[model samples]
Target: MFNLFGRSRKSNLRPPRAPGDTVRAKDLAYLQKWSASRAGVEGFVEPETIVNEMSVVFVDGTGEWTRRRIGGPKGIDAVFQGTGVPLYFAEETGYPQRMRDRIEKDRIVRERLKQRERRARLEQERER
Candidate 1:
């Protein structure tokens, strides 16, 4: 039960969470409807559906937003209905290479920085 510096460990594990993350199909529909109305709103559809216990991310004129757990392509379709937005698969409209590269680089850079910072902090603490 003892932690570093002899204090009692305050859960190295994830915090206790409330049950059942809900993703209302209607909210997703609303988001999609909004995206279709906005300019420069690019939609990227993975070859398969995205699944996790957490949330589904979408973009609109207001930027990125997420709704809790809506499963499958059918679920997304429902979002379109709610939002009055059309969902287009990326494969359908050949995407610009640079834009894809830009997105890739952005994500990679963020991940790299996070790892590096974590390593650096760990190293520094060890040396102290």
Candidate 2:
């Protein structure tokens, strides 16, 4: 591909983002907003594993949770400094069972919805 300036797209390549790349301003703002919206919540810092990148997960007493990718442990601390909630290392303290159950339930609901949609499509094809 070529650009209007007559330069090939490959020539205008940008550097790939690393795991420790700086967090975006919008993401920081969102994190602040989400934490402020909750009255009581706990933050969990999860280290980067094979399956997932480093992230921070916030959970309230009612099991409602929000997760976002953070830069690292230092970034996690800096982000949640204003929130007067406890932060824990997920490696030491496993995620709450409620969060796990909620994830599973959501997965099951999505699968069921997909199955229903597939059946509906099959029925429509049969009618045609």
Candidate 3:
């Protein structure tokens, strides 16, 4: 009568939460400090999903950004309650163009560095 593919009687049927998946006080504190230090910072609320927890992305005027878990949707208000940074649902407006530009810029820079390293290695082989 053993069923290897069936759920156990005690099973709750919920996916197990990974370690560090839950939000912590330091998450809020880090967001606060990072936002305070940056100018023209804005917050975008990202909804929770089966694969990931609710989180927020803060982008500054220069397109520099950071993301952190906010526990839930309500945590968005709690984090930016008094702060001047505007909050927007990422699902509605989508990410800003500047953020995308910054990402592209970074990617190009990394590719150039990798190319230079490869050239140096080839030169070393040629010299041998």
Candidate 4:
């Protein structure tokens, strides 16, 4: 047997709802509906619609967190008024990178499930 050395890569997985924009199907309607009535904000670059799946992340110097679905600026604005944390665009703030990684991890999990199904089918064929 020939052996080729390769490192087994480790994966980091975080729970969806500990904090930050962890959006579910039920929450999306509210975000979309609220953003629908909002006008474009002058200085920031935002997606055309704030889908419920989208997350708004805000952090202050005091180490507190503020996160929720993309319910237009209004959602973040309300959260900010008392919280005193400023909302920054995830794309510009590098939060998008975290989001991108999460999406990639989810895709990998789906692919792994499909592979399991294929292996099960192969075993069934062999038994037949």
TM-scores for all candidates: the values are 0.37, 0.68, 0.80, 0.40
TM for candidate 2 is: 0.68
Q: Give me the overall lDDT of model 4.
A: 0.45
What TM-score does prediction 3 earn?
A: 0.80
Clash pairs (backbone) in predicted model 1: 29-79, 29-82, 29-83, 30-83, 33-83, 33-85
Off by over 4 Å in 3: 1-23, 82-84
Q: TM-score-based ranking, best first?
A: 3, 2, 4, 1
Which sections of candidate 4 miss by over 4 Å? 1-46, 50-70, 81-86, 94-96
Q: Would you list the clashing residue pairs of candidate 2?
A: none
lDDT of 3 by residue, 16-42 (tens): 432344445777778888999999898
lDDT of residue 40 for candidate 4 = 31
Query: 1-128 in candidate 1: lDDT tens per residue?
Result: 98766755554343322233333646565555656666555444433322233233454444443333444455555544555444555456544455556668879999999999999999999999
**lDDT (Cα) of model 3:** 0.79
**Could you tell me which 10 consecutive residues in candidate 3 have the lowest summed lDDT?**
10-19
What is the clash tally of candidate 4?
0
Candidate 4 per-residue lDDT, tens place, 78-125, comes to: 434433334566567554443456567878999999999999999999
RMSD of 1: 12.0
Candidates sorted by lDDT, best first: 3, 2, 1, 4
Please report the candidate that would top TM-score against the real structure: 3
Q: What does candidate 4 score on TM?
A: 0.40
Candidate 1 C-alpha error for residue 47, in Å: 5.6
